[model samples]
Target: FASVVTAAGFSPNAHDPALFVHLSARGRTLLLLYVDDMIITGDDSEYIAFVKARLNEQFLMSDLGPLCYFLGIVVSSTSDGFSISQEKYIQDILARAALSDERTPMELNVNLRASDGELLSDPTRYRHLVGSLVYLAVTRPDISYPVHILSQFVSAPTSVHYSHLHVLRYLRGTISHRLFFPRSSSLQLQAYSDATWASDPSDRCSLSAYCAFLGGSLISWKTKKQTAVSRSSAEAELRAMALLTAEVTWLRWLLEDFGVSVTTPTTLLFDSTGAIDIARDPMKHELTKHIGVDASYVRAAMQDHVIALQYVPSELQLADFFTKARTRAHHRFHLSKLSVVDPP
Candidate 1:
């Protein structure tokens, strides 16, 4: 496959080996290959046709027109741009769990411990359900923190853990929820970085999360507990900013393959003025010396003009949603920003 693409004057991206690109004076062509299936798009229709023909000659290929569905995501086009959803997938999951209840999503603030309640007679179903929900999270950024929490107890799920599956109820009510990507000519990158400072009762580890956007479209997000315990809120926020910088760096390189030039430094927004001060400060002191290398890495990136740090109030921090569960009103407020539209 490598030789085939190279023979056709296409080179695989250094950041993502699965993506191949061919640039010419006529226009640019890009191929994103996932195992046997591939999606090809470019401005040069003639070059696209030639590449499809070339791939067909080597191996039989079925051309799915306009990418309506792939890997369980339903892609629907709109006048603005496109939206992707997993409505059917959510329904199937609810059926498998034999859950028919419906309601708005509530807080995932349940304080579950490993030793809390009676263990399930069979843990197999719990593992399977958690795995399915993990896949469903691909297009469902709203459920990130819930899925992240539930996945932790997969090995030894208890009856108490079952009560937290109310997130599925919310899914049933808002099945048509989709992630919309609007068309834009701007080739810019920005991200929101946030952290929950030592929230876990079991361990003192903080939670770090970030959301990355290209132009006006959200591209990536994550919610995960930090590997090590953070001593202060500032430390946790700095770690998160460093983490987002790494993602933004990779995204910038990936955009270059699509012929998108990110001329300005990527904007990184966070609520921590302390972290921002620590990142911008040149001198190191005894108080911050224990922050490890993450904070220093962010400062270096700033020096290179790869990223610019800015402050945002806590209420507007979108990544805050992924860092921890919030009240019903706060949940809706944050969800509204990341999820552009909802089911009518």
Candidate 2:
């Protein structure tokens, strides 16, 4: 596949090897290949068509017009831009689990402890369901936190762990929900970094979460537990900011490779004033001395103007949704901010 794309004057993207870009004086076209399936997109329709024709000539390929469906994800064009959803995928999961008629859950409840209940008779089913839900999370950022939590217990899942499957029921209600990418938004990168201090009762590890936006459309998000225990909230927040900075830096490079000039420093919003201070000031404080190299890494990025750290109040921290479960109102607000909406 690499040779084929290279022969056609397309170079593989550095950040994502599956992506190939053909740059020309007229315009640029992007070709993304996942195994045999490929998605070709570009500003020049004629160039895209030419690439499709070339691919068909080289190999047995079926050109699916306009990309309505691919790999279980459904794409719909809107007045604004595009909406991506997994409604059909969600329904198939419901049917496979025999929960098509089950009542949907409004919010996730992941307070399950390892000692909460007896182990499941068949752990395979639990693992399978959780794995499937993890895939469903590609376009469903709302369920990312819950899915991350549930995946942790895959080794020895119990009844309490299985209860996290309520997220599937929640998906049933908003099965048609889609993420909208606006056409008129800027291409500048903006990101939010947040952490929940000592979120796990089993371990003292904190939870780090971040969401990156390109031109008002969400491009990436992550929810994961921190590897090391932190002494203070500032430490946890700093670690989260470091992770966000790494992601933003990679994304900036990706945009530059796509011929998009990311002239401005990426904006990184954090709810921790102390973390921001730590990142901006080169001097080490008593609270931050014990911090690992991640703190220094973030500070250097800030110094190099790779990222601009700004303070955001806790309530407006959009990454909060990825770090932990929130109130119904707050959850809805974050979803709206990410442009994840149900079809009317």
Candidate 3:
């Protein structure tokens, strides 16, 4: 029964022992859980009673009415839908960072150019600062590129590197930000991907970036160095697309398992027209002959209608933030595109 429901479309993982249930009804097909407790939803009261009776017979059970708190999250009923937030968690992070005061967060600025117009010298303290800023990227994706770049010098940092620590000081003023999951959007899957060519000064290796969204809300994003070196900007961009294609495939599988049906050829946004053209054209041109095997697989998938690649202008590419440094204005603009806003 579990296998059939799961295979056909049901998430037993949702009812897993980790989540506690607070409310359930047979008539409405509503179910909630926290840890081992469960609240089922449906129109049939008798079915709900039967489930309760069965559970009672199998294990000791107590019926709790309405849910105030489950696990570490607080739940409140509303007319539209439920909202979740980690208020306690937010306070704890602030207290741990010793940033209880200073209401407004400093503007995020990671581009720390030297006063003399030279690349700043690296220092050991730079690593520590970069480490802190990297963790802070959980809430501020804007600084991901600069943080990643500064991290490469951990083994040997210079004075110029220490200068980058100022971004951490900036974060000290803004640790309270949190991700908001609004109840006001349809549940649709959308994705965007971008890459920067030869952004690393030392290795000249390009960086790959991708962002995935559900109903216009930023859900997942990543910034990482490419595993293999590519010869051209087009190749790097194709590599990023392949990675994005793989992610979308996995996400589609997971969604299908949860009873969500997405149409074939899901739209994916790409900033490089060269990459888009390479993906759309199945033939191996001179420029595309050396593309990695993974990228080739992605191009094949695009041609097969597994995904559709759409061209996005450079300025509109949110993944641009993931692959390169940007000014404060551009950083804020990308954050806005991700729908992240400072707490009121």
Each prediction's TM-score versus the true structure: 0.95, 0.94, 0.67
Model 2: how far residue 250 lies from native, Å: 0.8
Between candidates 2 and 3, the one scoring higher on TM-score is 2
Model 1 ranges with Cα > 4 A deviation: 97-108
lDDT of 3 at 218: 75
Query: TM-score of predicted model 1?
Result: 0.95
Per-residue lDDT tens digits of candidate 1, residues 38-92? Answer: 7888888888888878888999889888889888888888677888899889888
Ranking of all candidate structures by their lDDT, best first: 2, 1, 3
Q: Write the per-residue lDDT of candidate 2 for residues 17-113, one digit (tens) a residue.
A: 8899988777889998899988888877777777777777889988778889989899998787888998888887778655543222334445667
Best by TM-score: 1
The per-candidate count of clashes, in order, stands at 0, 0, 30
For candidate 3, give the lDDT: 0.63
Off by over 4 Å in 2: 44-47, 97-110, 285-287
Clashing pairs in 2: none
Query: Of models 1 and 2, which has the larger TM-score?
Result: 1
For each candidate in turn, give its C-alpha RMSD to the true structure in angstroms. 1.8, 2.1, 6.9
